[model samples]
Target: MKYTEEHEWIREEDGLYVVGITEHASEQLGDVVFVELPEEGSEVVKDEDICVIESVKAASDILAPLDGEIVEVNSAIVDDPGKINEDPLGDAWFFKLKVTDLSPMDDYMDEAAYKKFIG
Candidate 1:
């Protein structure tokens, strides 16, 4: 898994990259109330805003971690936004992308570095 400074996590599985906010981000956001996810099959560029998350404290955009086509979206979070606060890294993953080029995955921080970064 890799982590971005924006508090998003990236995990590659079966050729797709799964994206979700970190535990720290979930806590910071408070209880999640709403989620707006992008359509499946849509093309996305790295760093583009692709999803929205609303919490008791604030609303935030979830950025595309790499250029790719959105292969799948987890609508479960939309129906039950509180799931994000409950399990951010697992069942609360926002979406998965089928990136053609994976070189940029190298640019993100590893778990150890990300912990230090937040510190």
Candidate 2:
């Protein structure tokens, strides 16, 4: 998994990139109540806000970690937002992107660095 400072995580899977908030982010937000996902086919730039996640405390933007075209969205989390807190890295994933630039990943952190960063 590659992690951005904004707390988004991206992992390559079957040639597509899966994206979601880190568990640390979900914990910080308390409990997720809503998620607004970007539409499929939208173009996004690295570090730009592509979606929004709302919790009881506040709403946070989910940024794009790499430039890409949104190819799929995880509607399950939109319907049951609390799934974000329950399984932040798995069932609660927000979207998948068809990557356009691999260069931006050079700025992301590995799991260990991300853990340390949050700590």
Candidate 3:
């Protein structure tokens, strides 16, 4: 799992990555109400906003962890945004990307580093 300073995580498996908000982000956001997802096949660059997660406090942009094309989105979150607050690291994943390059992952945070950052 790789993390962004913005509090998103990207877990790479094979050549694809599953992206979601970190637990800290969900906690900070208060209560999530809506999630806007990118369309499948849409191209995304590293650090680009690919989705929007609206919480009771404010809407936050979900950034892409690396350059890639969106391969799938979890529509369950769109219908029930509370899932993000309930299980941010499990059932609330926002999207998947087919990574275009593995090199950019070097810039991301590891689990330990991310935990330290949040702390």
Tell me the TM-score of each prediction against the true structure.
0.97, 0.97, 0.95
In candidate 1, stretches whose alpha carbon ends up further than 4 angstroms from where it belongs are: none
Q: Candidate 3, residues 17-115: lDDT per residue as tens digits?
A: 998999999999999998999999899998888899899989888888888899899999999999999999989999989988779778889999998
Off by over 4 Å in 2: none
The lDDT ranking, best first, is 1, 2, 3
Candidate number of the best TM-score: 1
Model 2 poorest 10 in a row by lDDT: 59-68
| Winner of 1 and 3 under lDDT | 1
Roughly what TM-score does model 2 have, to 2 decimal places?
0.97
lDDT tens per residue, model 2, 3-109: 98888899999999999988888999999898999999999998788898889999888888888999999999999999999999999999999999998888899
Cα lDDT of model 1 by residue, 20-87, tens digit: 99999999999999999999999999999999999998899999989999999999999999999999
Clashes of 3: 0
Rank candidates by TM-score, best first.
1, 2, 3
Score residue 40 of candidate 2 by CA lDDT: 94
Return the lDDT, model 2, position 8.
86
Q: List the residue pairs that clash in candidate 2.
A: none
Which residue pairs clash in candidate 3? none
